[model samples]
Target: MELTERQKRIIQIVKENEPISADNIAKHLYLSKPTLRTDLTILTMTGILDARPKVGYFFAGQNFEPLLFEDLYEKSISEIMVPPVVIKKEATINDAVTMLFMHDVGTLYVTENQVLLGIISRKDLLRSTISNTSINKVPVAMIMTRMPNVVTLQEDERILDAGYKIIQHQIDSLPVISKDNPALVIGKVSKTVVLKHFIDEAMHLKK
Candidate 1:
């Protein structure tokens, strides 16, 4: 709930003139009465102000963290990324499946010595099994979607970008890579990470 400058000023005005009417507050600030509607509602709901229908508005004896909902998606990917789960590129598709289930992650990176070779998901492994080729005999290298095609994020990219790319690519997870060496997989961010932000924001009520 990032309070606009006008909203903050409105709070200050209300604090100075307790039980002030909305029309007068707007007049004092030279703003249209209707323009203050949403601002007042937000301030009131967030516990920063109080109101009674006929009595007008008053300070709620509470303060809100003005930046609570500000630019959340603009946060950097490194801040939201979870540890990457990896398997050897040479490992069998069966091995990749085991690692996928073991970690309970939607996607896994195919790597050797921390360098990201490719990415594998349950869908990728599933598609392999349905093919004429024997999934158990197929190597992860053959089934995994290799880089140059894999959608990835850098450490400093915004988490919002992660969300956008996730929806754009229709993938479950994104690998966070180093800005200097794109091959180096540093971390990962999933839909769960983006969702956790919304959940925390909602649960983080109470001034």
Candidate 2:
């Protein structure tokens, strides 16, 4: 989605002093809270920013290593990743529930023949089960977010750039795919993992 000039400006401001509150952002930008909230919501949905319920929004940070971007850009997503937990399209809601709990994940990519088809998130499962008669009877595909337009980062992209994408897109995670085989998922970059590294680096730099 194309961001307006104002939206772009807002992103810049937030990136500079992140983990900042909406009210503060609004004050700084001279915008109304409602307008800022709308923009933030859109940005968050697009995976450009991370908005915690009370913690506010923050730009994803990176380790303080003084290495040049080139030093990190050549690395592939496979170098820093965890195996993805996926569910099949034919899987039942019960199966999704089980996998979600077992994997300790809020979302699961649905795949068939090793190709991504959709995503089933905790919210999706909850909504389905809550409004349905048989949670175990329903196929996950019935409620899964289909063909979720995925964003991928090259293995060699700077980690900081990945963080920026997360902030810019307002997404909690990104699927890292090989540049050669874009359809083949290699790994995921989660907000939790990125934030941990960033916070650790910041703390270390303070010493």
Candidate 3:
């Protein structure tokens, strides 16, 4: 789980002055002890800080690092991925556009005979519509980011792997391909999905 800025500051203060009282920590931050009650509780509960009866908080020496890395980042993509919005290769640009809005997705996967072919995004459809008046007649395949060019994830890949590619490539989403058959598309992962997963997990753990 990620910590708030105030929580990080609390940890730093405790490290510099171990066994310091809650009142002293609050004084260092120019805040009241009451205001820091929840922060202190979370830090201690997560094992990042240790508290004694009459003593105070101390850094727990990275006891929570393994929980954050192993339980959260190392999770498989299949655990959080959702079904992809797909279209056939023969579908027109108009059809692709309609499907995009209907499903409220950033990108649409194009396939032929249940095999992956390419991807169409809002940018692609916009470009095609601006140049051609006959959007109904133009096939989406005419202007799609095709296979070998489209970046994708496998079901067995870790969430950390997907997160890195999403940031590195600067893309909003990725289609998940089947491990048994690379040609088949199975699921979808997006920025929203990743953020939701982290937030939900964090909230659940907090409770």
Among all candidates shown, the one with the greatest lDDT: 3
Name the TM-score of candidate 1. 0.65
Local accuracy of candidate 3 as per-residue lDDT tens digits, 13-39? 999999989999999999999778767
Query: Model 2: residues >4 Å from true position, as ranges?
Result: 1-79, 199-207
lDDT of 1 by residue, 1-207 (tens): 366799889999998998999998999999888777757766775568889999999999876765543435557888878999999877888887788888899998998999999999888887887773666677889877888889999999986578678776778999999999988999999989878975675576533
TM-scores for all candidates? 0.65, 0.61, 0.70
Name every residue pair that clashes in candidate 3: none
lDDT by residue (105-200, candidate 2, tens digit) is 877888776676777778888888789878778889888766546665666665656766777677666766667866766667777765565455
Give the distance in Å from residue 183's predicted Cα in candidate 1 to where it truly belongs. 1.5
lDDT of 2 at 87: 82
Give the local distance difference test score of model 1: 0.82
Q: Which sections of candidate 3 miss by over 4 Å?
A: 1-64
**Candidate 1, clashing residue pairs?**
1-69
| Arranged by lDDT, best first | 3, 1, 2
Per-residue error at 23 for model 2, in Å?
Answer: 5.0
